[model samples]
Target: MKDIVEQNYSSSQYIVLIFCRLLIGWHLLYEGVVKLMNPNWSAKLYLMDSSGPFKSFFFWLAQDKIILPVVDLLNQWGLVFIGIGLMIGLFARLSAILGATILGLYYLSHPAIIGADYLLPNEGSYLLVNKNLIELASLLVIYLFPTSYKIGIDRLIFKKHE
Candidate 1:
């Protein structure tokens, strides 16, 4: 079966998809930049505060001095790269998948299940659904619809090959 859906989407559909992509990209980029700018910023607290079934693994990742640095670097850079790719519609599908994966990891580590609490306060209350999951779903939709090649940098990049 084909992975990406191919269709002649209406202008409105394209507009909505592009809007979503840009918004998500901006959010990711902002997060990455904030982390990058702060020398003291680290995922240690967040990982240590994890409360899901994978709590042990996340805690291990946070406590490991060697691995922690690598993890912090990858997380920050990954967000930046993914955000840029999505914003410019360059390798958008890959960006969407990567974004979803990162968000998935976040959601798994801090699930919004009942009675679960964390050191980091949530902006809103949730129960089994939250912004991370919503954003992850949005990325999945972006991946499935894939409008970058039609209206993004991908258009120029892939047009030469086509």
Candidate 2:
């Protein structure tokens, strides 16, 4: 009975992990492709403008000019790399971590785009918490589980090892 239960649980977990990988991969792919196709679709305008929520923070960063070039490069390349990695399940854990970090930074910077005031009682404006939180959770889940093995290059590599 115990063995049967363990097998069932493992099977369920496998299904869930596969779903997660597909969901995350597709989302990243769409976002990266959109950004790549539209070079003008940059976070700088939304993030560093006066109308932006974190206008002060972004303005300060621009003024001080600390790591601007590195940040810019990472912002561009990181999205593409993370998207590709997730799509192919290559270094999935690392990709998830990097993706989560980028998402967290975006969340922190904005936080008032969604307008969910009931759940979070803030004075200024409501934050886009739901999608960001969900994405963050998904990334963490992918990091914890071995989703790459289900339908990814990791499976081929590990098969040779075995």
Candidate 3:
């Protein structure tokens, strides 16, 4: 078996990374729970309000009677699972990547188009970028570092064999 490579990270680095992980996880969990509890909640409006060149694709998804429900289920569950995984530092790399992917799709759906305004949650305004993009970047960083290997569940479960 190939030995697992260990990198030395400062305590401050671990603190900051774990903090980011927990915060992002909490955000995802909150969103998922909100949507899950609200029986009337639906992403239809969000999709319909999508802009940019991919507006039609999103609109199509919104209007699709068959696919919309599936999307909803997957979206909700995806958030919950990713949230739990990240929060617990279990399979964090996978969770982070998935989270980043979802965030990317969100950014693409609304796309901080220049001179364009969206009816999204009050995150203020931007010309060609937004909170989603920022979160995606953070997720990317999380994925790259694989903090789970340092101070997460992955560290406990998967022991390195020399």
Query: Highest lDDT, which number?
Result: 1
- Alpha carbon lDDT of residue 44, candidate 2? 54
Ranked candidates, highest TM-score first: 1, 3, 2
What is the number of residue pairs that collide in model 1? 0
What local lDDT score does residue 76 receive in model 2, on the 0 to 100 scale? 70
lDDT of 3 by residue, 1-162 (tens): 122226566899889988999999999988998999999988899998898999999999999999999889978989998998899999888999999999998999989988666788557868676889999999998887667777788878775764
Model 3 lDDT at residue 153: 89
State how far residue 53 of model 1 sits from its true place (Å): 0.7
Worst 10 residues of 3 by lDDT: 1-10
- Runs with alpha carbons beyond 4 Å of true place in candidate 3: 1-5
Question: For each candidate, how many residue pairs have backbone atoms clashing (under 3 Å)?
Answer: 0, 1, 0
Q: Candidate 3: deviation at residue 28, Å?
A: 0.7
Question: Each model's TM-score, in the order given?
Answer: 0.94, 0.70, 0.93
lDDT of 1 at 99: 99
Scored by Cα lDDT, where does model 3 land? 0.86
lDDT (tens digit, per residue) of candidate 2 on 65-106? 555545655777787788777878887768989989987766
